[model samples]
Target: MPSALLIIDMQVGLFHGPDKPHDGERVLGNIRRLIQQARERNVPIHAVRHTGPDGSPIAAGSPFWQLLPELELDGDIDILFNKTRPNAFHGTSLAQHLRSGGVDELLIVGMKTQYCIDSTCRAAADLGLKPLLVADAHTCMDTPVLAASAIIEHHNATLNGAFARIINTADIQF
Candidate 1:
């Protein structure tokens, strides 16, 4: 199986803020375990950082835009990308890069389940890449429309089959 792991927007601004995403601590632990497995299998690991407008929390080149220190990416093992849009493939070399590696399937784990994670999954499917969303490893803050837990549930139900295969971190093989 040609697979790659996409760690989308797991940055300081999103995770280390005053108002945190739901189940963030547990999600981080899950993501950390996923990274370890991917590395052990020699799978490609792509770390994507989301860029914000000037003066915003995740502004480009700001400390907040940096990936979480807990990640500890190996220079030779991990690839990095900075995206200004919600979808990781938009205006990024992601598609071509994945193709170069002959990656037919993508394992996505990240922040903001509705925005980045949802968009990325749909877009990846549209581009003909199979997306596996780690249900327990992605999260978002509560919105006026729904609580954080509800949002996660909604996306998991909606994205499954149509855009991606929903899987749990513990059940992931690589």
Candidate 2:
């Protein structure tokens, strides 16, 4: 089955200004590597952007809506889906896009561990798409009760082999 990399919610809204979360810069290198590898192998790459109502952080035209510059995307992106909800599937064409592309497996990487990232993974499973999350590729801001690292570790451990498999970027041999 053909696989696609679902690069979700890497927009400027999540990374620019204020204190950023969980070393987004650090994990970006890994995301770039994955993009490069996928390109070389002719694998499709789809980008998901999140938008919200006025005054929302991810409102349209905000700097945060743009993807980070480090993980460069070319004009040849397989698909670009705009989502208003946490789950990428909610009112979006993501499922149809994947199905039309003949994509059976998905490599997920993005932001906000407890929100978009987590929700999308579960939704993909519900849609019968095999979702593989890059363990170290997604991160979140530090919370008062838990550090960012701990949150990431917990999500990986809790979600591994269930919500999704936790694989390092290096383990993606495809």
Candidate 3:
């Protein structure tokens, strides 16, 4: 099984400030665990950082645009993908990179459960890649209409068994 780990938008900006996602610390911890497991298995890890328009927190060159320090991207094996759209594959070479690496399956973990994480998972499936979403490894901020926990729950239920198989971080074999 050729597999890769796709971590989407786990930037510093999402962790700091008042707009932080719910259970962000736990999410980051889970993502770190996934990274460690992937490294041990020699599974490629690709990180997608979202770049926002000028003046936005995640704008290019902004401090927040970078991935969180907890994620050890110093390894030569780590790959980085930058995107402006919700879907990581949009305007990015994520699909090509995966295909080139002979990666048929993707383990997704990241921020904003209802946004980039959700979009990327669906896009991966649509692009003929099998995606396994790490249920507890993604998160989002509370919206005006729904709480962050609710949003997370909603996405977990909706995306699971549909666009991707939702698995717990511990349940992931690699």
Candidate 4:
């Protein structure tokens, strides 16, 4: 089955601060590579942008809610979806879009390892779609309780091969 690359929440607000949870630059580089590969292979790429309720940092119409520049999305190569909740599947046409495009496997990547990344993966699995999370392609900032590295390691260890398979960029064929 053909796969669609789901690049979630690489928005401006997430990468704006000096203290980025995951190494923003490194994870973004991985996303860049994946996007390029997808384009080269004629695979579909979708970017999920998060918008919170009024007054939130990621509110709609704010520059902070836009995707970061590192991904270099082209109009022909990428599609954009607006998501109000953490799980992009909730009340969104993402599933329908994938199904219509004959995408059975989803390549997941983006911010907040413990939140959006985790939620979206589980939701996709529940919907019977194969989800492959690039282990090094997603990242979060360090929290007070655990370091950023620890968080990424924990999610990859616990989530990989259970809910989703955590593969690195090289593991991907396209």
TM-score of each model, paired residue for residue: 0.97, 0.93, 0.96, 0.95
Give, for candidate 4, the lowest lDDT window spanning 10 residues: 15-24
Evaluated at residue 28, the lDDT of candidate 1 is 95
| Candidate 4: stretches off by over 4 Å | none
- lDDT at residue 39 of model 3 (Cα atoms): 89
Write down the lDDT of every candidate, Cα atoms only: 0.93, 0.84, 0.90, 0.88
- Candidate 4 backbone collisions, by pair: 21-140, 21-141, 21-142, 22-140, 22-141
Which candidate leads the pack in lDDT?
Answer: 1
Q: Higher-TM-score candidate among 3 and 4? A: 3
**Per-residue alpha-carbon lDDT of candidate 4 for residues 20-105, written as tens digits (9 for 90 to 100):** 65677788888999998998899999998889888888888788888887788765657887898889899899999999999989
**Which stretches in model 3 have alpha-carbon errors above 4 Å?**
none
Q: Give the TM-score of candidate 1.
A: 0.97
Displacement of residue 53 (Cα, Å) in model 1 is: 2.8
Please say which candidate is ahead in TM-score: 2 or 4.
4
Which pairs clash inside model 2?
Answer: 12-64, 13-64
Query: Mind giving the per-residue lDDT tens digits that candidate 1 earns over 25-137?
Result: 99999999999999899989999999988999889889999999898887676999899999999999999999999999999998899999999999999999999999999
Lowest lDDT 10-residue stretch of candidate 1: 72-81
lDDT of 1 at 119: 98
Error of 2 at 29 (Å): 0.4
Candidate 2 lDDT by residue in tens digits, 1-174: 789998888888686757687888778888889999998999988888888787887787677787777778865665766788889889988899889889989999988888888899999988998989999899888888999898888888887787787899988977
